[model samples]
Target: MKTKRVMIASEEVEYDIIRSSRRTVALYIRPGGSLLIRAPWYVPAYVLLKFVESKAPWISRHRDKLKEIRPDQPSTMINAGDKIPFMGRELTVRAHENSRNGIYVIEDEIHVSVYGALTPEKITAFIDNWYLKEARNYFAERTQELVRLHGNILPVPSSVSIRKMKRRWGTCRSNGAILFNRELIKKDKELIDSVIIHELCHLVHHNHGKEFYALLESIIPDYRQRRRNLRNL
Candidate 1:
């Protein structure tokens, strides 16, 4: 494996080159926009560079698309008519001037009513505020239900917290607090429940070793599938 810096359009992107006994060259962009190129061992560096250069436009477009959906890139501008994910579905955001300023979800769409001027900033404020509100109510409701069902087997967390987390879905602290990423409000309930149950398991076993996963399995049998689905988000 070798690393090479290639210029795509005006952006300098680093691509990892893996040489194997394969027959052809294949280019791919990983989840976080890391570039990977696979080629036969006989292929030379100059040939790979040429191929990447030719595919630069396509690669750059895809890289941007991947970056836009990255969990940590939450600061990206949320514009009107953009599709926002909430509870496993994508809803179109529509902002309009109204006497009352509020947000609502109806028939796979989000309606944002702005009492004054309707701008991108105004819509963003509405969306951000909406997500936070939903996160609190949704996560609280789920924690209560899941705890009621699994409280008999696992040690319950001392407290459950829902907050903004860029790179993690949830965290389990030794202090017996479970912090869930508020961004997960956009995801499905199963994934959220998986994360909550995961942290709850940690209250009994702090480590992710055999004992922890064993406890997790005993409670949620299909946790691995839910974890895989979470990554796709």
Candidate 2:
């Protein structure tokens, strides 16, 4: 394997080149945004560079999508001035000592009022609770809206629930239950809708066969572009 770098659309992209007895050249964006190219041993370096350049648009799109869906680093400590992601934007955190213990949002800041000592743990707890409450209401409403908009083609989920999932945005069980990851609240509604619609399609077709995607595309024609990370799931 040889590592090479090229400028695609003015962006520097580093890719690994693996040559074998394979008959064709292929490009892939591996997990974490690494690029890989496979080609026959007889292919020249210039030819490979041209091939990578030809795929500039596809490369750029997938890389940008990967960045959008990348997992954020968990906060070890929460403090005033810390930024928190909500609905695809960052909101600054403002901690205050007050007689009432509560949380509210004003403009671009999340105001946390604590009656007792203001600690990182307290702030984290308050923020997590707020996210969960908001996610529960938002996901449920959106799921219902999508189902109604799609008419009878989509099945109504028996129940809609929210939890913290490590690897998935949502899941549709064979029993008709749909569960969404509470962390999904951090993403924009477009991506959220894609997950909801994907699960809803699963209600009609349990597996990811051609029939399932056919139904999904009928509902969200641009689903692949909207939910790039979902393709892997």
Candidate 3:
């Protein structure tokens, strides 16, 4: 991976370039306004730079939108009354001290009960662990349902796994395995399903070519809209 700078729309944009064995040139604007370009190893540097220059307007628009939606500095500490994003809704965090440690959600609040003094670290850990468990169960069941619903067009995944990923919502490996970012569990089901369907389509079409998107559109007619909604998040 190499970092490069380019002039896009008169703005000096810095981006990371990662060349892989993959066959396509893909651009990703990650959260917090970072730019990443994934290209085939055979593509020349000049070609990649020209490609970035060509997408100047798109880069500028999406980058500005991302910066606007994302906070300049997100707080790292979790405290009572703090709002947490869950299933596309902001749920208030409520802390309690009890004889036993436990956590649950009620309506729009996450009630966290700790056996001892409440600390920011403990609260963060409890919430993260809870999200992980929920992501595993939710993604597994939902993936199965989607596969069953679209069995004629979708392929059953070799396996489904979840983890915290910085830049990707979900990915489909060459071996037919699907891995989803645990953070996706924070989004609404519609966005989650969009990612699942996108990866499931990959099981049939391994690349992001015309046929792949054609299949995707056949299943989710508004996938483009879903992607736009997700980028806003």
Candidate 4:
């Protein structure tokens, strides 16, 4: 990888390059604070440097945004005062007396009555289980409809699965198994459907080439708007 160092905000920063044919130079910070600079394949080093200088403010702002969106909840443990997002709302974790019910979904909270002592690790595990169960049921039915509509043209096999992925919302596996992001259940139903269609279309054309986009447009005329809306999630 081609790499270089530049100064930003009085700090000297080094970044790796991924040269592409795209006209713009994009910069991003990784979780470890390392920066990445993707520039036009044939752009000169001086030109790329100028682009980076012009976008320093925007880059700094976006880096902060990424940090804000990072989910620290995954490692957090559940307890009496732990706050969690149940459905779309935030709820404080409350442990009540153990009931016949393994987990209870109250008006706007998750009431977990444990038979024994509670730990943060256990709480996080229980919450993840709850999310997986609900997500599997929700995404399974939605994926089926998209398959029914376009399964014939799918390049891979027809089975589908839904998962919770931190980086991507959906992916079409080479084996024809379509995996959807479980977190999508938190979004509106229409946006969920758009994500489903987007991944399903990928089964027909693997790459985002002209033909792939054409196929997607034919299936979903308003895809661009739905896509833009989904990104707001």
Top candidate (lDDT): 3
TM-score for candidate 4: 0.54
Q: How do the predictions measure up, each by TM-score? A: 0.65, 0.65, 0.67, 0.54
Worst 10 residues of 2 by lDDT: 66-75
Candidate 4, residue 13: lDDT: 61
CA deviation > 4 Å runs, candidate 4? 1-75, 78-94, 99-101, 149-157
Give stretches of model 2 more than 4 Å off.
1-75, 229-233
Query: How do the residues 168-229 of candidate 3 rate in per-residue lDDT, one tens digit apiece?
Result: 99999999999999999999889999999999999999999999999999999999999999
lDDT of 2 by residue, 143-176 (tens): 8999899868998999999988888889988899
RMSD of each: 16.7, 18.7, 15.7, 16.6
Off by over 4 Å in 3: 1-75
**Native-to-model Cα distance after best TM-score fit, residue 92 in candidate 3, in Å:** 1.3
Residue 95 of model 1: what lDDT? 85
Which of 1 and 3 is the better model by TM-score? 3
**Per-residue lDDT for 162-182 in model 4, tens only?**
766888889988887888777
